[model samples]
Target chain A: MKAIILFGHGARDARWREPFDRLAQLWQEQHPSTPVQLAFLELMQPSLEEAVTTLAAKGATDLTIVPVFFGQGGHLRNDFPVLLEECRGKFPNMTLSATPAVGEDLAVLQAIVDFGARAL
Target chain B: MKAIILFGHGARDARWREPFDRLAQLWQEQHPSTPVQLAFLELMQPSLEEAVTTLAAKGATDLTIVPVFFGQGGHLRNDFPVLLEECRGKFPNMTLSATPAVGEDLAVLQAIVDFGARAL
Candidate 1:
């Protein structure tokens, strides 16, 4: 089965994980039975390697890595590439597709407005 | 000069700070005369109180606190408001207007698309 991994920047604050977990749970509510997992670049557990290996062990040959970051700034474009490169080396035979980081979606505009969290 | 405070979730990993700092610098580049400061909600240094106190000391009466978070998730909508409430009490006479958190702007759509960080 295909697996989706949500990668968060990972924070030390326990409060920080709440939203990420909530979103993951919300995503699961829509995709019940879908194999989804979480990985942190740092400051948290389940490093990218750990998440990838776990999914691989579970027979997920086709994997999708979604950067849970806000923009395509350095993290999504630069650091994440490095992270995925390492993951790619580990799962060479696996077909992996890295989705654009969050906030890269046009649809998110309304969500932002709905949240009333917009500037200007 | 006007002042702006960018509040981050504060990650334990050094890598996570790069983007926030970079953006702070970029914003500075555009507004050379403006005094921009960085604060962390947790994990990092320069807490909200510190950032605000520094600004207040510098004669900033009309302040605008910008949540550097991605969405209105718990931190932006919940925790941050609480932080501001505390600040409001501290600066009772100060006029502070909080802009929407980042990613809440329609203009950010292009940045997201430009980053090619979209999932769908």
Candidate 2:
């Protein structure tokens, strides 16, 4: 089975995870076959490693991590790679891969522009 | 006149602003009459006040600020209001309003979900 993780830079505010929760729910609703999980980088529950373990336990052989951030900053460039490497080391049998930050997607940016246009 | 400002949380890495730059370019290209500016909360150039000033000088009497953040955490809920208030004080004649974070938009969230689906 294949699973996906929406990784975010967690914040001190509990409500900060609301969108991530919504993203996971949306993914699950649209892609029922692909199990979805929400993972945080820090200051939140279910770190990337924990999320991977949960999916691994559920027989997920391949996993994709999508960084739910607006920038490829130090967290994505530095912290994330180390964590991913650790996950790879721990889950040697599973195939793990990642995509560029969702912000890098043109459609995502266009959506934001549309939202601003509507607001104006 | 009316204008828009795409506000984002700045990062230490300069390359982090590439998406934001693209967003401004897209807005300018699509809505040339409205005019667009980029602002950052911290660690980047062109603060919100500066953006407001730029638009004000451009003869913009009404301005809309769109928070380009994923979650309404302390930054959006707490810090942003303070900054907006300061801008209002500095530019008292300009009519300024702000929308909820772009992440709060259903279309934006759907776009992210679609991006993940395509990657999978």
Candidate 3:
């Protein structure tokens, strides 16, 4: 089975994870066959490794990790690769891959623009 | 005149602001009459106050600030209100209002879900 992980930069505030939770819920609702998990970089539960383990247990063979961030800063550019490599090394049997930050997607940006336009 | 400000949490990496720049460009292209400016909370140029000042100089009497963030953490719930108040205090004549974080928008969240679905 294939799985997806929506990775985010966690924050000190517990409420910070609300959107991530919502994202996971949205994914699960729409893509029932492809199991989805929410993972945080720091200051939150289910780090990337933990999420991978959970998915691996669920018989997920190919996993795609999507960084749920607005910028490809040091976290995505520097830290994320290391974490991903570690996950790959630990789970040698599973095929793990990642996409660029969601912010890089034109559609996502257009959605934000539309939101702004509506608010104005 | 009315204008908009796309506010975000800045990052140390200069390249992190690419999407923000693109957002401003898109806004300008699509809505040329309603000017748009980009602002950062920290570690980037054009703080909220600066953006407000720029719009004020452009003859904008009513301005809307859209928080381009995925979560309403301390940055949005706590830090942002203080910053907005300071800007309001300085630009007393200008009518300024802010919408909830873009992440709070259902359309934006749906767009992200669709992006993940497309990637899978």
Candidate 4:
């Protein structure tokens, strides 16, 4: 089975995870077949490794990690790859892949533009 | 006149601002009448004050700042208000307002969900 992990740059404030929780909920609701988990880079629970372990134990053979950040900074370019490599080494049985930060998506950018337009 | 500023948490990598630049471009293209500018919270050029000043100079009497961040953590709840207050003090004549972070928008979140679904 396939699973998804919505990864984010976690913040100190607990409230910061609200949208992330909402994202996971939406994913589970819409894609019931594909299990979803939330993982954070730092300062939040369920690091990438933990999330991957959970999914792998749940019978997820293939997993896609989506970076929910708006920018592909050092975290994405540097830190994330190392983390993924570690996960890959630990879980050689699972097929793991990642997509670019959500901000790179045209539709996501368009949604932000639309949000700004509506606010104006 | 009215203008918009796309506010973001800047990163050390200059390339991280690509989406922000695209956002400003899309705004200019779609809303030709409303001038747009990009501002960073830190580690980037053109802080909020600079963007506001530029817009004010461009005959913008009303300005709307859209936080491109995904979460309203301490940065938004604590730091952002203080910065906004300073900007307000400097440009009292210009009406400055802000919308919630783009992440809070249902449409933006939906776009992210769709992006993840497509990647799976």
Candidate 5:
């Protein structure tokens, strides 16, 4: 089975994770067949390694992580890969991969533009 | 005239502003009448004050700022309001308002979900 992890740069304020939680809920509601998990880079619970381990235990052999960040900065380019590699090493049986930051996607950018337009 | 600012949490890596740049470009192309500017909270050029000044000089009396961040963290909740108020003080003639982070929009979140599904 395949699973997806929506990874975010966690924040100190507990309310910061509200959108990430909503995203996960939306994914589960839309794609009930695919198990989804929320993971954080820092200042949050369920680190990437833990999320992967949970999914692996749930029979997820092919896993994909989507970085729900606006930019591919040091966190995504530097810190995220190291964490992913560690998870891969720990979960040797499961295949792990990741996508570029969601901001890199044209559709996501368009959606943001639309949001800004509507507000104006 | 009315204008918009795409405000983002800047990073040390210059490339981190690519998506913000694209968002501004898209806004300009789609809404030629409404001017748009890109601003960064830190580690980048054209701070919110600079962006507001530029738009105000361009005859834009009303402005809207859209935080291009995925979450409403301390940066947005705490730092951003101060910056916006400072800009408003500096450009008292211009009306400045801000929308919630782009991630707060359902369409933006749905677009991210679609991106992840396509990648999977």
Candidate 6:
């Protein structure tokens, strides 16, 4: 089965969950059959390890990793690679290719500039 | 005086604020006596409007808005500009120059790529 994991920076204020959870829900709506999961680097439950394990448990050998982050910061650069290393060890049989972070994607920048124009 | 407003997406888990708060503290340490303010686009208090006014209230006519966001997501594209427009009406005397969102700027991309290389 194909499984997708969306990672986000964890937060203390509950409101921070709105977008993450909303995106999870929305992405699911768009891809109904894919097994989707949510993970955080810190300060939350269902971390990267847990999310990977859950998908593995469901017999998802094809995994698409998506970081729901705005930019490529420490988490994207350092933390995620380390997480992926552990993931490789745990799910040796699974095939994983990470989607570029939201920050690196061009469509995202377009959306941002398009929206920011209102300020002018 | 030059005042800077650092905007971040607030979160429920305190860990989310670490980078934001830490960056704010770091910038202040670098530029002592140059009034700096922290605000959130959402999920936190002392929001954009408040931050602008706070800087204005402190008699800061030259405002440098540095979005602490990782990318040019919704806040940079949508909310921030609207906030800035209102700021114009409120603080017309203030000279505002917004740096490109952290996402569009090349330095940020290098940081993300440098960090992600570890995963390989």
lDDT of each: 0.68, 0.94, 0.94, 0.95, 0.92, 0.68
- Which runs in model 4 stand beyond 4 Å of their true positions? none
User: Candidate 3 at B88: error in angstroms?
Assistant: 0.8
The CA lDDT at B12 in model 3 is: 96
> At residue A37, what lDDT does model 5 achieve?
97
Provide the TM-score of chain A alone for each candidate, in the order shown: 0.89, 0.99, 0.99, 0.99, 0.98, 0.91
Instruction: Report the number of the highest-lDDT candidate.
Output: 4
Candidate 6 lDDT, tens digit per residue, B1-120?
887876776755444555555555555665677777878877777887798888888889888776755445556677788988887887788887787655454444344433333333
How well is each residue in B1-120 modelled by candidate 4, as lDDT tens digits? Answer: 989999999999987999999999999999999999999999998999999989998999989999998888999999999999999999989999999999899899999999999998
- Candidate 6: CAPRI quality band: incorrect
Cα lDDT for residue A72, candidate 2: 92
Can you give the DockQ of every candidate in the order shown?
0.11, 0.85, 0.86, 0.88, 0.84, 0.07
What is the TM-score of each predicted model, taking all chains together? Answer: 0.58, 0.99, 0.99, 0.99, 0.98, 0.55
lDDT of 5 by residue, A71-116 (tens): 8888999999999999988988889999999999999999988998
lDDT tens string, model 1, A19-90?
556555555665555566788888888898898888888888877777767456566767888888888988
Please write out the lDDT profile of model 4 over residues A2-116, one tens digit for every residue.
9999999999999999999989998999999999999999999899999999999899999999999988889999999999999999999999999999999999999999999
Tens-place lDDT digits, model 2, residues B7-120: 999999998999999999999999999999999999998999999988999999999999999999999999999999999999889899999999999889999999888887
lDDT of 5 by residue, B9-78 (tens): 8999877788888888999999999999999999998999998888888999999999988888899999
Among residues 3 or more apart in sequence or in different chains, the pairs in candidate 5 whose N, CA or C atoms overlap within 3 Å are: none
Count backbone overlaps in model 4. Answer: 0
Query: In terms of DockQ, which candidate is stronger, 1 or 5?
Result: 5
Candidate 4 scores a C-alpha RMSD against the true structure in Å of: 0.6
Taking candidate 6, what TM-score does its chain B reach relative to the real chain B?
0.85
Lowest lDDT sum, 10 consecutive residues, model 5 chain A, at A69-78
Model 2 residue B118 CA deviation (Å) reads 1.0
Candidate 3 lDDT by residue in tens digits, A30-81: 8999999999999998999999999999999999999999889999999999
Q: Which 10 successive residues of model 4 chain A have the least lDDT summed?
A: A19-28
